[model samples]
Target: MFRQLKKAATFAAAVLATTTLVSTAQAADYPEKAITLVVPYGAGGASDLAGRALAETARNYTNEQPVVVVNKTGNGGMNGARYVTEQKPDGYTLLLSRVGMALYPAVYTDSPVAWDDYTFLGILESTPMILAVNANSDIKTVDELLAKIKSSNGATTYAASGPTAIDGFTVQALLADADLDPLSASTLVPYKGGSALAAALLGGHVDFLAIAAGSLMPHIEAGKMRALMVYAPKRMDALPDVPTAKELGYNLAGQVDGWSALFAPKDLPEDVVAKWKDILSNVATNDQWLDLAKKRGSVSVVGDQDPAAFVKSQYELYNGMAKKFGYIQ
Candidate 1:
C-alpha cells in the first residue's frame, strides 16, 4: 500500500510540473529581447504623435523596456507596411499603422500588401478633423464657407496635410456632394503636418485649414481659429457651437479612421497575443492613459471595446468608401 501511494504521488507531481512548464514557456520565450515598433509615417505627423504616446505608455503594460519606434516611411505609408508584413512573425516586431493601412490597398491598385497577412492589437484613440479659419475671417459657419467658395469658384485656397490625406479626401468628398471639383472651389495648399497647417491658419498664411479636433482646441479657446464644421457624429465638448458636416445643407458624411492601435506579426503565439491584449486593455482604462490622452487631445478607448469593433467596422467602411469615391479602380 505504501509503494502504491508513493507512485501515485510522483505521477501527480509530474503532471502538475508539466502543466506549469507549458503555461510559462511561451510567456517566457516571447519578447526575450527588445521589441521594435514601426511607425509607417515620418516623425511629427499624427501617426507619430499617437505612436510615441503608445510607446511611452506601453512600457508600463509590457512591464519591460519601452518598445523602440522605427520610422520606415514612403509612398504615403505603404513602404513601411510592406516591410512589416514581410518581417518574421515574432511578437518583438510590430507596426504602428493608420486607417490608411486598409484604405491604401483598396485605393491604390499597385499597393504591395494584403489585410490577412497581419494581426491587429487594437486602437488607442479616435480624432476628428475640423474645417477652421482665422477668428477674424468672415466665414463663420459651414454654410458661409460653402457659399463663399461657390461664389469664388476655385479662387479660395485651403490647406491640407498632403495629396492622399484624409483631410484632402474629406474636402474632395464634400465638394463631390456639392457638384464642384474637390479642387474646384478651393486651391489645395500642401503643408507638412497638422501643426504646420494650424500655424499657417494662425499666421493668416492660408484662408482656412482642415485640422484635427485636439490640434485646434487651444487655438479655438484663444479665439485664434474659428471652427466651421467637425467630422464627428455628435458635437465635441471643446467646440459645441461648431456644427457637424452633416448638419450643413450638404449631405457629406464620414468618420475617417484617425486612430492608433497595436499590430503584431500574423503568426505570433496565441499566448503572447493574449498577454498583450490583457496588458493594453488594463493600460487603456488606467488614469495615466486617460491623462496622457487628454494631453494629446484624443479620447481614451482600447482593446475589445473600441478597436475590435472599429477594426471590423472600418474594414467594411474604408472598402465601401474607396469603392464609392472612385479613389479605387
Candidate 2:
C-alpha cells in the first residue's frame, strides 16, 4: 500500500512539472500569431483610440507582431469585456479595459462581468472628462448650466453612453453633489458612443454632456463647443484655463474620469504577464504613443500603478459612489 501511494505521488509531481514546463514554453513564444485587443466600445471613442494606439506602439516591442484591435460594442462596454474574460488565458486575446470596467460592476448588480474577471496588465492612460455645451449655447460655465437645469424644472437633458457608464456618472455625480437628484435633475438622453454623444450635443439633440475629453477636444479647440469644467485631478495643460470639478467643489465629479488599461483572461501565465509588462513599459514612453495621447487630451500612465491594486481601488471607489448616488443598493 505504501509503495502504491509513493508511486501515485511521484506521477503527480511529474505531471505538475510537465505542465509548468509547457506553460513556460508557451509564454516564451508568446504572440506566435497576431494578438486581438478587444475594445468594448464603438469606434471614435476614447477606449477605441487608446486600443489602436497601444496596438500600434506595442508592435515595436512585440517583434512587430500585429496587435489587432477589434470593437465588440454593446451592453455599455460589458459585451466586449465579457468576451475577453471568456477567452483562453493565452495572451493573444486581451482587453482594452476602460473606466467602465470598474464602474459597470458597481452600478449594475447583474453586471455581466466583474472587476476581477481578468488579469489586469496595466493602466494605459488617463483621459479627462469635459463638461461642455455647443458654442452656440448661452450656457458658458458649469454654474450656468446647473442654474439652467434647476430653473428648467427637470426639462434640461444631457447626453451620455448610458446612466451606468462612466460618462453618465460624471454628470450624475455633479448633480448629486449640487443637492439635486442625479436621475431626475437633468434628463439623461442615452447615446451609444462618444461620437454620437458629441454629435447629440452639437446638433442640439441634447442640452449638454460630460464625456471623455478626447472626443470633445477637437470641437472645443475649434470653438464649436465650450468647455465648462474638467473632471480630473487637475486642469489639463491643453485646457489650462478650465477649472477642475474639485476646484469647483464638486468632489464626486472630480473623482470621475476616463481611463483605459490592458487585461487578459484570468490565470495568465507569469511569463506572458512579464512579457506584456515589458512591452507596455516600453510603449509608455514611445513618442508616437505620447503624441497620440497629447493630441487626444489624455495622459499616458502605463506603469504608474500596479494593475491589480489600481483596478481594485477603482472598483471600490466607484462602488462607494454608486451607493452614495443611489445607482445601486
Candidate 3:
C-alpha cells in the first residue's frame, strides 16, 4: 500500500512539472504570428490613429511581427470592446481602449462590458476634447451656444458617438454644470465614430459638437470649424487662446477628457504582460510615435501612471458623475 501511494504522488508531481513547462514555453513563444490590435472605433478617428501608431512602433521590439489593427465600430464602442473580451487571452488579441470603456459602464445600467473586464497594458496617449461649431455658424462661443439651446427649447442638436460615450458626456456635463437639464436642453444626434461626429457639425446636420481634439484640429486649423472651449486640465498649446472647462467653472466637463490605452483579455500570463510592458516603454519614446501624437494634437502618456489604477480611477470618477448627473441611480 505504501509503494502504491508513493508511485501516485510521483506521477502527479511529474504531471504538474510538465504543465508548468508547457505554459512557460507558450508564453515565451508569444506572437509567433501577427497579433491583432482591435480598435473599438472606426478608421480616421483618434483611437484608430493611436492604435496604428503603436502597432507601427511596436514592430521594432516585436522582432518584426506585425500588429494588425481591425476596426469594429458600433454600439457606442461596446461592440468592439465586447468582442475583444470574448477573445482568447493568449496575448495575440488586444484592444486599443478608449474613454468609452469607462464611461459606458458608468452610465448604462445594462452595459455589455464592465470597466475591469480587460487587462490594461498601459495608457498610450490623451486626446483633449474640443467643443466646436462650423466656422460659418453664427454661434461663436460656448455661452452663445448654451443660450441658443435654452431659447430653442431642445431644438439645438449636438453630435456624439452616443449618449453614453465620452464625447456625449462632455456636452451633457457642461449643460448640467450650467443648471440646465442635460438630456432635454439640447438634442443628441448619435454617430458611430469621430469622423461621423465631425461631419455632422461641418455639414450643418448638428448645431455643435464636443469631441476629440485630434479629430477636429485639422478642420479647426483649416478654418472649417471654430473651437469654443477645450475640455482638458490646461489649454492645449495648439489652442492656447481657448479656455479650459476648469477655468470656465464647468467641473464635470473639465474632469472628462479623451484617452487611449492598450488592453488584452483578462488573465493574460505574467510573462506576456512583461513582454508588452517592455515593448510599450520603447514605443513611448520612439520619435515616430512622438511626432504622430504631436501632429494629431495629443500627448503621449505611456508609463506615466499605473494602467490598472488609472482605469479604476476613471471608472470611479464617471460612476460618481453618472450618479450626480442622474445618468444612473
TM-score of each model, paired residue for residue: 0.84, 0.93, 0.92
**C-alpha lDDT of candidate 1 relative to the true structure:** 0.74
In model 2, which range of ten residues has the least summed lDDT?
A: 320-329
Q: How many residue pairs collide in each prediction?
A: 0, 0, 0
lDDT of 3 at 7: 100
Candidate 2 C-alpha error for residue 236, in Å = 1.2
Writing each residue's lDDT as its tens digit, candidate 1 over 66-119 gives 689889988777788888888887687888877777666656667787654578
> What digit string (tens of lDDT, one per residue) describes model 2 on residues 72-110?
988878999999999989899999999889888977889
lDDT of 1 at 186: 82
Q: Write the per-residue lDDT of candidate 3 for residues 131-177, one digit (tens) a residue.
A: 99999999888889888988998999999976767887899999998
Alpha carbon lDDT at 198, candidate 3: 89
Best model number under TM-score: 2
